[model samples]
Target chain A: MSEKHLQTGDELPAFGGKLRLFAMRFCPYAERSILVLNAKKIPYDHVFINLDQKPEWIFTFSPKGTVPALEYEQGKGIFDSNIINYYLDEKYPEVPLQPTDPLRKAQDKMLVEQLTGAQSAYYTAAFSSPSLTPSMVETYHKGLEVLQKELEVRKTKFLHGDEPGLVDYTIWPFLERFQALPLLGKQEFAIDKSKYDVLTKYIEEMKNVPAVKSYCLAPETHAKYIESRAKGNPDYNMLDTSAVCCMRPRKKKE
Target chain B: MSEKHLQTGDELPAFGGKLRLFAMRFCPYAERSILVLNAKKIPYDHVFINLDQKPEWIFTFSPKGTVPALEYEQGKGIFDSNIINYYLDEKYPEVPLQPTDPLRKAQDKMLVEQLTGAQSAYYTAAFSSPSLTPSMVETYHKGLEVLQKELEVRKTKFLHGDEPGLVDYTIWPFLERFQALPLLGKQEFAIDKSKYDVLTKYIEEMKNVPAVKSYCLAPETHAKYIESRAKGNPDYNMLDTSAVCCMRPRKKKE
Candidate 1:
């Protein structure tokens, strides 16, 4: 894992002999693909970049310079969270995350699209935009209600039946971030446990899924990152571990 | 083909033995799927509904009362143009519009996403939106330039190949609708013959594709629809031919 924020003038990182993902520490979109990668147990290298001042090479991987771009080969890549995740699931089909039925697969994608309403509302709330309307808050609740209904109808431990699948991973990142809304002073955005009982339980279960558990962050951490980004100076290195040493100081011929 | 606008309290159209698609007369999104069905020579029926006054049963087919919902079974469906197209391409593999190569498939979807900039701009211009900005025009051109660049690099008669594929059909509708912009007084939206020689040629070829040729309307017709829609009264059933006789009023067939 490399947590370096390579800027416009920085050199491209040396290619590692594994699938590589260009990501930012705090992007929910990036986490969607990450969860899929972990769920499939695919061996890969994670390259974290600063979104605000992205390196030129990032565009080579992602045309829009967006995160969650996968460099499957030294110079070959693909971007877009859903596209990348679908590619990953198909290419590494040893553990398929998508449902086998075509209708089920379409429904999974629809669920992801439906959840984006709340995600958009979260974005507005996090960015502290003054234009965040009441309807936006309503949209947030409607999104949650849709998920709860789906949970009840599917009658599964996770949206993906016994375990989390593509649908679960695709929407989990947004749900994971939605928890930080109350901390951001957007109380209306918080999930009311009493109302969303099924969804609430599902969230708890997702946090325990090995794939998500391995990489998910707490609401406080997300809130802090949101605060910094809202102030126009995103703290992209909030989770950097590259600075840590091997517990031994450098010594000559030690 | 039924170009009738069934409103609330209207009966759901009886299931036709074959697959059915709920569409609107002038919707580009709906046309996307229609073209796919035609290109594949799939047996299906089309139900043209009035979007503004959607039938109560429309939700049974499409959750959001949106057009282009595919009624694959008696009471089951999958919404979203892309989702419907993917389902059709998968279920009816007799003619595969999608590339077998995963990377190429991803790129095809990405190109659709990329062209959305121009589509949004066209929407704004067609609606005569006050919010239309110079940046919107810039975005429209940027989208065109991107397509031009891709066409030049791919060196293919069509985006898919000599034969039009999913990418071509997916994008052709928007390109078809875009021609209506110049007629709507948005001259900036015009595809200058000299500036976009390649794209212009591609557009002409797509219009001639048998699948597209059968259903696509003239630019003047599209411009008229845009004008009516801009006036807040969309002439949805402008081309209604449901009342027309099979030929000479059945010529006293009885």
Candidate 2:
């Protein structure tokens, strides 16, 4: 068996020392978890996972074989980025990530689901395609349009109204990545910044935040990562649009 | 618009001032929220939603357009059964549905995701088909095999461990429905109880629980529901699977 295919057993790393976040730096889901940790000022270890060849330990703990798994002390491993954020909120009740209002909390979670489920597909289709197909572009635009409308309705400084909360932390990473992808000769899908004034302003505001800004990759670097994948480099563990994009745009017959 | 499609916007009848849970009796996701209410013994008005004609409020609040949704006193609606359950657990912390141990909590959430993402697909394909196809039956059995193996390894009374927790509540309702559909002759997917002794015992134990048993359709009634759907009744929302059986099996096709 390839060394890359080895499995990581379900054991938590020693804790009260440092919590390990197994993540891919460019993955929005992973980024969301990091944003929560940073926002809460929690100190921990960050293990940047190679998505192409996921460590066996990761698969052992997360049977779904996904990244952004958390290893807390006492040999407990938590999978799913959103659940991990919730864990942090519960474990560290101070500076809660979710809202106190039950209804608002529900909305926050629904919006996160939308980002992951609906909008993701559009971004994925655009990024994975060898050349930007018209269908892929349209899908990306539709996703952005939906996001733009939702942001308009919220009319908040961030996704969850006023201060950045779980919703904002969860979505911004993807939105930023979507915008960054255009530098790789992927045509900039018109976002109509004026249509989503709140989102545009929120993006600017998020960039100013020390933690978000610190982790934010320069556009050129991100494009380089995409370029490497397009070149079919075997060692490419970089962000492949296929991994991140959830929406699969219908392919047209050649 | 049909009267059934319109929302009165009026408050639904409440039990102890808690809003009603309008859901299909057999939906596992719906059961998750209901389990929370049952575990807490929280009084709630139970309004069974007809899957054939979903209420407009349900579609408006639930973006995915599935159940179970909750209507609060202030016209605030919560959608997505899992998110709604989280709202309930957080707002009514007196009887917590989630485990306090971070590791156990993570495992609980992961198990719930697996049930929804992996296992549920089999039930969806099998039960949703107009006629049970061999391929659908194969898919259903494959899902059951994975579930059986997982149960064997854990050997817990509930999905998480000894006591029933969130994952058990989330999955049990769906499994109940999946098992019942075959008895109706709508499908003929086999699940050998002997192969999964723990799961067999678990299902029996679940059946005896007053809350679970009370909500479950009498075997005769559930059989009727399945038969009605098979007859192409417009009122039946379950998928017809008759065409599936005519198709070749997966291994042969490959």
Candidate with maximal lDDT: 1
Highest TM-score among the candidates is held by which one?
A: 1
Off by over 4 Å in 2: A1-17, A73-76, A93-95, A128-156, A159-163, A181-188, A227-254, B1-18, B46-57, B124-163, B181-189, B218-254
B1-254: candidate 1 lDDT, tens digit per residue: 55666666677767888999999879999999999999999999988887788788888877788989998988888889999888888888899888877788888878888888889999998896788999999999999999998899889999998899999999999898999889877898999999999999999998899999999999999999888989989998777665674653534422
DockQ-based class of model 2: acceptable
| Alpha-carbon lDDT, every model | 0.88, 0.64
lDDT of 2 by residue, B123-178 (tens): 44434655435665665555566676677778776666666666667777767766
The pairs that clash in candidate 1 are none
TM-scores of chain A across candidates: 0.95, 0.77
Candidate 2 residue lDDT tens string, A1-254:
00121223423233455777777766678888888888888888766656665566676546666878777764457888988998887787777767778767877777666555434543453456645466656656666666667777877767765677777788777777766565655555534577656667777888887768767877676567656655655333443454344696534423
Q: Specify the CAPRI tier of model 1.
A: medium
Residue B187 local lDDT, model 2: 46
